[model samples]
Target: MDRARLAGFLRARREALQPEDVGLPRGPRRRTGGLRREEVAALSGMSADYYSRIEQQRGPHPSEQMLAALARGLRLSLAERDHLFQLGGFPVPRHAVRADHVNPGMMRILDRLQDTPAQVVNHLGETLAQTAPAVALLGDETRHSGLARSAHYRWFTDPQARTPVPAEDHATRSRLMAAHLHAAYTRDGRGSRAAVIVDALLATSAEFAELWREHPVQSAYCPPKRLRHPEVGALELHCQVLVDPDQSQTLMVFTAAPGTESDEKLRLLAVIGAQRV
Candidate 1:
């Protein structure tokens, strides 16, 4: 969208980091804002001229290795690294939207993971398909609840959504989901439906808007989640997200580690979910 602003943001962030911030020694009488272009070039294994071109918006495509180096030199957070990649025209790593719809095999995979509270989500965290247990895990009563709705709408607008999960955990999950969605939108040329979803979420939730603007990117598959389920009380759940190599979908499964109270509680939830089904 704003290529110039993107480039400027990258340059500004690069210039904002001190030499010591990136493990470089502070030199004598430096007049520039942050680390010198030559210093960044040295850290990124590129010529100073080449790095200057990048900063000036005249450079050619940057390789993945170059981006990684720049990210390290800039001391970028996960979000910052992703924004750098997008600005450099590098392929953002994650799923992409396809012209074809979700495959039946993928749907079957979600069905089979019934016991494991699983759902099929697009790269944008939209729940394309989900199992009964997965819906229950998120405390959604309806059978057709979408991940986008669960995350953007209910999480922000509905008190019941926050009631089932601790405040801190809910915020973490929302940020993580937003980061993943941001990567998806960036990778898809910034004009896909996923990007629209991001814009809508940004418009609706100020928190989502702030995180999206930060441009965080994460491939967080299995993060721990704390749930205060209405029926089950407090429980900790581990989330596992599987990226479908052949398709632009992620299979997110929630499981409790073996021989723990969480595992027992998850089992109980599974039983209750089965009865409702």
Candidate 2:
């Protein structure tokens, strides 16, 4: 690894960011330029000492996962993220098929909605980024990877994933997910990420494979989703999706019907979620 170059790049990105850029406050006593190294470490999900070591060019080589976290924490663009990987002596991720990078437009929207439950998820059902409320509301969707990264895969392969959705909607959601995967698999063809997921689901999940055989092709995300939170109970929130065509990323914003019990619950959720975060 080009430790010196990597450290310099990380430092540059860190200094270039303001506290407000990453949903942090600039306190009255603060005198450091941009975000503190500790703040960056917190955002990157690493210890302050470890991150400081890397910045000081005295740490061990950073793994690809750590670099990925840093990229997200730094809010780097796709090109910049690739550059970070290259600088760390890691190959840039191939971008022809799968895309996890949240486009700038979506990031802007997410940045503005600190209280709302919003997330940028790719076509393959992998959540790329989520707001604090989203983490609280949906139990941190960004915590998984591999086949588990796709909620559809998790739905069939693991029973625990159905906690959010009611039992009644499971069949419909499964069909929708299966249809979505089929469409993506067909569009991308062989050896595609979607195809890999499809193959895995077909082999492991009989229900998913059954749903796939039915050839359901609904691509549009349904509105007014019924999601249950262990803390908030059942919530009837509308799911508004904004799609970025170039990146195949969908930004979903969740809001409840105003003046209703659900609205009151969502308001409570903001307070409850903040504490959880």
Candidate 3:
């Protein structure tokens, strides 16, 4: 760990905030500006002595979990949190690295492609936003919360999520999900959001456990996707993925070639969805 830089960053973040900002009372007798070291320790759920040692640059390497707590306590933005993790000599968790904000370029493209089935998803497979046609195709996957918010997490936990995934394709999807999550876990290591999902699955899913042992470790998998929509029946569409490196968000647009039955069904679904909206 870069103790000096980490300590400096921590101290700076603590000093930049007011007691009121973190929902604490500022007593009249308080002489120092910003929050005290003790307050930071309390907010971070660590002992004052341990926290002080870190600020003093004398402590052992802080784990990723400790850094995450510090990030939360300091109310660090996604970029700031990433800086903290870097200073701590740990890669920021991929899920933690995901920013919910869609960039203007992406937004503009989404606006122009209103009739297309498109959605933006973060690195963790959480849908940040979706076009109406995308919602109609995927059933508004952005509606989930907590661990279930991740499409990867829900594939094993929610049966409804697997409904669109054909029985023949279940193994492939499961392998893909496991492989992608494995890549995430490898990147972030322990105390990561991906680890949390893996832990939960290890405890609950026998299938996940088996696949985790023997799965393709590919991080990027893009194949022509098949969707079994109840209203539109079956659709074989090309799944195009656009990545924003700064935000780690993916724009997945579904398209079918012209003069195809899938193309007609896609447009019809868009019209139907727009009418419902």
State each model's CA lDDT, in order.
0.66, 0.84, 0.81
Q: Write the per-residue lDDT of candidate 2 for residues 1-277, one digit (tens) a residue.
A: 8999999999999998988887788899888778899999988789999999999999789998889888877888888899999989999888753386667567767877888989999888889888888887887888897889987788889889887899999887788778878877877789888888898988998898788888888767574689888887898989889889888888998898789888898888878874643
Clashes of each: 1, 0, 0
After aligning candidate 2 to the native by TM-score, how far in Å is the CA of 135 from where it should be?
Answer: 2.0
**Root-mean-square deviation of candidate 3:** 12.4
lDDT of model 1, residue 118: 82
Candidate 3 accuracy as TM-score: 0.63
What are the TM-scores, per candidate, against the unseen true structure? 0.55, 0.91, 0.63
Query: Residue 276 in candidate 3 has what lDDT?
Result: 45
Tell me the tens digit of each residue's lDDT in model 1 across 122-188. Answer: 5555565556677677744333344334354455545665786687677687777677667767777
lDDT, candidate 3, 1-277, per-residue tens: 8999989999999999887766577899889898899998986779999999999999778998788778756767767878898999988667554455455456545655667889888767888667779988888786688889888889988898899877888988898888878876887789988798889988888999999888558656598878798887898999899988776677899999898999999988988893443
What's the candidate order when arranged by decreasing lDDT? 2, 3, 1
Q: List the candidate 2 regions with Cα displacement exceeding 4 Å.
A: 96-98, 274-277
Candidate 2 has what TM-score? Answer: 0.91
